[model samples]
Target: MPKFAANLSLMYNEYEFLDRFAAAARDGFTAVEFLFPYGFIAGEIKARLRDSELTQVLFNCPPGDWAAGERGIASLPGREEEFKRSIERALGYAQVLGNTRLHVMAGLLQYGQDRGRHLEVYLHNLAYAAQQAAAHGVTVLIEPINTRDMPGYLLNTQEEAHAICREVGAPNLKVQFDLYHCQIVEGDVAMTMRRDIAGIGHMQIAGVPERNEPDTGELHYPYLFGLMDELGYDGWVGCEYRPKAGTSEGLGWFRKVMSNKY
Candidate 1:
C-alpha cells in the first residue's frame, strides 16, 4: 500500500488549525503535510507532531499574500531576494519539524515578464536552494498549479515543470505532481505518472470539480492507486481535499475507499 499523508490544512474542518495534527493521527494517517505553517511558532508545531507521532512529509514555503492575489513570487523577476528569504524561513521550520520535502511555490507570471528570463532566474534560485536543502537531507518540490483553479499561475503544466527540473539538473529538486490539479488540467493520470514518476517527488489528491474526498469525485482513485503500485512509487500520497460536510464525516468516505484495498 502507498503510504498516506493527510494534508491537515485542507482536510480537517472540525478542529482549529493547530489541532489537526491529532485529528490526522486519529484518522490513521501516520504523516501529514500543510500549506504554510508560518503563522504559528515552529517549535509548537514540532512539539505537537512529536506528541501525535505524525511525521511531517511535506510543507510549502510561504507564498505571498493569498488575499492580495499574489499566488507566489518565486519565479517572477525582481523578487529573487524575497524568494530566497522565503526558502530560508521554510528551511528553518522544516528542520524543526524533521520535514524531508519542501514545496517551492512558482509564483504567477507578471505582465510583460519574459518567460525565458524568469525561467533562468528560477533555475538559479532553485539550484541554490537545492544545494542548501541537500546539506540537511531535505528535497525541494516544485508544484504546477492548474490555471483553471489558479488563474495566471506561472507553472501550470507537467511539461513546464519537467523542463525546469531538467534545466536545474539537481537531484534534490523535483516536481510535486498533485493528482487533482493534473486531472483538472490534463486527464491522463496513469500515463502521466508513468512518464514523469522519476521527476515527481511527491503527490496529492482530491475529487475534481468539488475538490472533496477521493471517492466522491469523478477520478477513479483505485485504478490510479493500482497504477502507483505497479510503478513501485514509495512516497506518500497526500489526502489534500476539502471536506464536503464536517471533517469527521468526510473522513468516513476516505476510510471506506482505503478499506476496499484491504
Candidate 2:
C-alpha cells in the first residue's frame, strides 16, 4: 500500500492548529500536510514535527489574502511579482521543515473571456516557481480542484495540468493529483492516475461527493490503493478528507487497507 499522510488542515480539527501535528502522530500517521503555516513560524512547526517524529510531506504556497477569499494568485494576470514572492517564501519554509514538496494553487478564473489571460499568467508563474524551487532541490506541484467544490478554481482537469507541466518544462514541476477532485470532474480516475503517474509528484485522496472517509464512498479506495502499490508509487498519499465521524474513528479504512493486499 502507498504511504498515507493525514491532512492537518482538514483532519483532526478538534485540536488546535499547532496541536494537530501531535494528534496525527498519536493516530499512527507518520507523515502530514496542510494548506498553509503562516500563523506559526517555520521554527515552531519544525519543533512540532520533530517532537512528534512526523514527516512533513507537503504544504501549499501562500494563497493571496486567504481571509479575503483568494484561493491563489498564480493564475491572476498582473500578479507575477506576488506569485514569485509566494514561491520564495514557500521555499524558505520548506527548507526549515525539511519538506521538498510544495503545491502551487492556480488562482480563480473571473470569467470565460479572461481565461486566456489567466492561463498565460499561470504558465508564466508556474515556470518561475518551478525554476526557483528546483534550485533548492524542492519540487513544485499544481493540482486540479473540482469546480463543484471550488467553483472558480482555474485548473480543473488532468489534461490541463499535464499540459501545463509540459509547457513549463521544468523537471521540478509536477501535478498534485487529488483523487477526490479528479473523480468529481472526470470519472476515469483509475486510468488517468495510472497514465499520468510518472508526471504526478504527489497524490491526495478523499471520499467523493461528500469528501469524507474513504471507506464509504462511490470509489473503491481499496482498488485504488492496490493499483498504486502495483504501479510502484513511492510518494506519499495524503489523506485530505473531512471526518464524517471523529478523525481517529474514520481511520479504520487506513487500517483495513494496510492489512490487506486490496
lDDT (0-100) at residue 238 of candidate 2? 94
Give the per-residue lDDT of model 1 (tens digit) for 1-262.
6788998888886789889999888888899998889999999999889999999999988787878888776777788898888888999999999989999887777678788887877788888889888988999999988878888788888988999889888999999999999988888888999999999999998988789888777888878888888998999889888888877777765676568742
Top TM-score: which candidate number? Answer: 2
Provide the overall lDDT of each model, using Cα atoms, as 2-decimal numbers: 0.86, 0.91
Instruction: Single out the weakest 10-residue window by summed lDDT for candidate 1.
Output: 253-262
Identify the runs in model 2 with alpha carbons over 4 angstroms from their true place: none
In candidate 2 the C-alpha lDDT for residue 59 amounts to 94
Residue 129 deviation, candidate 1, in Å? 1.3
Question: Model 1 lDDT vs. the true structure?
Answer: 0.86
